[model samples]
Target chain A: MTLILEYPNTQLKECLIEELQLQCTSWRFAVEANNLSPWNRIPEECANYIKDYMTGKGYQFDLDRVSNEAEIYARSVELKGDGKDAWIFDVDETLLSNLPYYAEHGHGLEIFDCMKFDEWVENGIAPAIKSSLKLYEEVLSLGFKVILLTGRSERHRNITTYNLIKVGFHDWDKLILRNPEDLKKTATLYKSQKRDEMIEEGYRILGNSGDQWSDLLGSSISDRSFKLPNPMYYIP
Target chain B: MTLILEYPNTQLKECLIEELQLQCTSWRFAVEANNLSPWNRIPEECANYIKDYMTGKGYQFDLDRVSNEAEIYARSVELKGDGKDAWIFDVDETLLSNLPYYAEHGHGLEIFDCMKFDEWVENGIAPAIKSSLKLYEEVLSLGFKVILLTGRSERHRNITTYNLIKVGFHDWDKLILRNPEDLKKTATLYKSQKRDEMIEEGYRILGNSGDQWSDLLGSSISDRSFKLPNPMYYIP
Candidate 1:
């Protein structure tokens, strides 16, 4: 009886292990390769942890790290003195934080509330992340022309400009928000095209910084790209 | 002229706001509720961040949290002194973590290499989760019988048994592994049946703990269930 049981168990064990091994291999691929579906929600613990970072010193440290990188790159660039040395900065989360809005509304842990966020935008009370602000000052002193490029619509340009200056940003060579007709373009496409235009206009984009991957992945990517941590959300 | 220029832009802005608002609501439901595709992989950042936790203090804190809950419940239970009072524990990541296996192989961040993992398993060197170990001892002293149920197949019984005892788990009244013939059963179905059998045998399962939701959510569930975090992978 024991032998009969042992015989089948041995065979089954081998098969089961093989199957489990295969399953493990596939799981590795999915995770490492980012092969997940777009519609899937971020896990709750992860979402909350990200929110915590935003509320805590962790977020500032990350911004500081990005700023440090920006400063190093800025210091190394030799200015042409022809208004051709440029740096692109994404507006939301990269310069001004959206923490207060996110803190009340789930910080990307829940679905976005556009009307609510739009109202928050209109309030325009977002404070500058001190690190980014410091970097902004450093770059301007280094003679790198700062160009503000954001996904916010052109309709909000007046308010966006107000907020930028209110938060201590000054003298950006250009502040380019998305045009009404540019709404159809993905952030990457729109931003990439804009960078291409800058290059055509003889401006050398020395560096670009943003909180989203889409902000940095397209054509005319700068000599250096700094990604500030923004686990709150992903923009396509 | 000013009103005409503003009219078209205002109408478009309202239309855009309406569309964006709808998208936001759907995002909230999906994220906060974990309404995601089963087949989808975890987001890469989340996966890597979880791996960071496994190697850092986050995992220990989670294990500590589970143990704390277990201790409070264990202390409150008054066992009837009948060998019938029991607690169930799912083996992997509940008592012994596969973190070491995952750490060397991308911590579930990369594709699972089955043969490599199986080789790791064969080494029988998995260490006990300290928090779970404390809880294991606490319940044993509380006069509740311990039953270990794992999805690992019967063929692995020798090594599995060795690993458990080596990892500070001792004197479990029963250690149940899936039989070769039981390979066709779903984890929920198979485990539920085993739990039913325990019920038939008069085992009063006061508590159960597992890393997988499946391990806790079926027929014959215990009076209370504790879930230890395991973001590395999911079991069907």
Candidate 2:
């Protein structure tokens, strides 16, 4: 079972580690034997804690394919015609599921290990949610404009776009990544303003779907807004 | 000839009085001349300023009509059914032209004198703008709802509603007057929040037409936003 607690911060992380050392025999033995202290330098220990927490809970920690498929289907409705209005999708957990990698790494800070991620993308090993991928293909076939909007910093733009193409997201109009300076500010306000600016340039926002509130709240133009389930973790 | 200038504030009163005294030779002066200085003191001068401004700008201004029949005619569009989205009109320039009363009394800080306004409504003296009033009636007859959303305070709701009814605006869901407290905040945020709350309750806003930016900016739910001409004066 995968535990789906709201992702807590460093303070909670320390407490969880201390509690696990005192309780579960398996956890205590594994920690001492491996010299694993998530609270200390070992990042792998933290990943283990997350995995154990999930097993302690009742969930299977499966990636939600149904909801992701529904979103892509709904979004494809706008892409069916000459495609005057375009769709801009987020990357992580949206177009591609990153939970498995995160689960293995134990530390999100290390999840962005570009070399490993690039290799994964090159191999097309990162599985696409079948329904969502089908919907994306439908959108392209219908000729609606498609763009990718990601919170990933601009430095990752080239690799991200290349990876997306390699993974079958083709014929995109643009791939937008965050400016480094903008990432320092509240993420929500930054995305909203960018969306609004796009709308003002005459792109009708038929729909906006994202896991975080910041992605949708700033744009005044969206005809509809959808929130995807993000039970595994949260950013803000 | 009527000599209308922008509504005179205290500082502008002396200059306005001088200009009016020199230019308005055709119409006999009705108000007490001694009270004309410090513009706020002379309600009659203020009224004249509004009237002359309208005339100079080629916008027909009427005072006696309780309803803007002409405006209603020009603005009405047909909807699908008898069920209609109503327009909540503000009384001052939106429905009835208040220039005659303003011209006679000047602009004063006194609360709106509804008894006097009631007499005008009862008289039905103001002729409607043929196009606008026709639009209003067309909208009304087509089963679109007509609402009166005004900046008038709560104290004036009864009289305002009565006056609207007296002027042939008999059917409406509600007359929303601004709360006195709402006047203290940023008009944009206050109006937007209120409109959003109303929309949350399931009202589909087809369009919102108003002369002030405050009125139009307050509601984000409307399908379309229209700004009426307000060339003669301004509120802020």
Candidate 3:
């Protein structure tokens, strides 16, 4: 350890970079585990790391693994044929890919502008997350009704629907979004309340999937809620 | 991508190995997220990865990061000063480091023998995880009560206590272990019941920290639960 402290200038520089990488890796773990919630943006130092992570194969691989497990869980469940067996899916990062927008704008906390995001939504060009699309298709084939619960506002309903369909997400039983009055409520409370209404209507929530913990956490959550990784941001 | 498939033999072998590593990394993400629950062992291909992760700086760095966040969370709360603010910790990987045994035995599915594990526990030489130890001390200084909860059977109580005290863990208000009849229940149910009893007695659980999901999940879990990464094993 003493010898390392005596390292040459070049080695010291290398050590600093490595230290930064390790710190970022740890932050990623905490972010994914929900230990660091109520966070809006990734640490500024981790901007490049987050960009590489989202653009590189790691993000897709993580999604693929989670989706595979979701399929396994779906297969394990003997779905009731009563048409009340529901699978909850969160929109933005869960079913739709906002990667292009995040990619172009960068993740340095500057790109999260509300107006800019709304403009992206209006474009209706968000792609479908391939792994999620596969799970959506499989769960539907297995007789589970898909309920798309999103934090997006009701004003974006037309664009969200068009984009979802254009990007290969279709035949979902319901696309529930926030109403005008839900603007004051948190995503967790809003989604939870929506789920409660669904349960009251006799739907047995078998599986819920989302990139944000708020979507899968809180009251009325399903027994098998799968949290997909989103190291870029956190939603309570 | 197509050109890579036509690479020479040596390059093709490297490609295959890289693919295997990617698969293992994906598995690690799933394991950490608790998406792949009811799992007993890591994937065969991931054994080396797990060994490297647990032994290298990654594991310690993760612990350090989580512990630092735990401290931040602890400092955020103004203590009730009624001795009711309790911090829950799981015994095995949360407080003690079983690294020596896991390292020597090799995590190759063969090291999980019941008798072998019991023998290790009897030694009472397990060291305290430095990161956790720091948090343990800091929380105590911050006036939070430490409650050690474990799934270890009652038979290992004396040695467990010895190991903890020897490793500088003392003044803990309580150490909860499974009873003879509690063996029939899962760790989730058992720990939840204990927390419920604690609540009945007026303790408000402020934080829960564990390496296993079961330690922090279930009915009576805290809102500020920290899941320290343990890619080694999953105990439901």
Per-residue lDDT over B62-83 for candidate 1, one digit per residue giving the tens place of the 0 to 100 score: 5675677678888988889979
lDDT of 1 at B167: 79
Is candidate 1 or 3 superior in TM-score? Answer: 3
Candidate-wise lDDT, in order: 0.74, 0.50, 0.87
Instruction: Report the Cα lDDT for residue A159, model 2.
Output: 68
Say which prediction, candidate 1 or candidate 2, comes out ahead on TM-score.
1
State TM-scores per candidate.
0.46, 0.37, 0.94
Ranking by TM-score: 3, 1, 2
Model 3 misplaced stretches (Cα beyond 4 Å): A1-14, A108-111, B1-17
TM-score of chain B of each: 0.82, 0.57, 0.93
Ranking by lDDT: 3, 1, 2
DockQ of each: 0.01, 0.01, 0.61
**After best superposition, candidate 2 residue A3: deviation in angstroms?**
30
Candidate 1 TM-score versus the reference:
0.46
Kindly state the fnat score of candidate 3.
0.64
- Those runs of model 2 whose alpha carbons end farther than 4 Å from true positions after fitting are A1-83, A106-126, B1-236
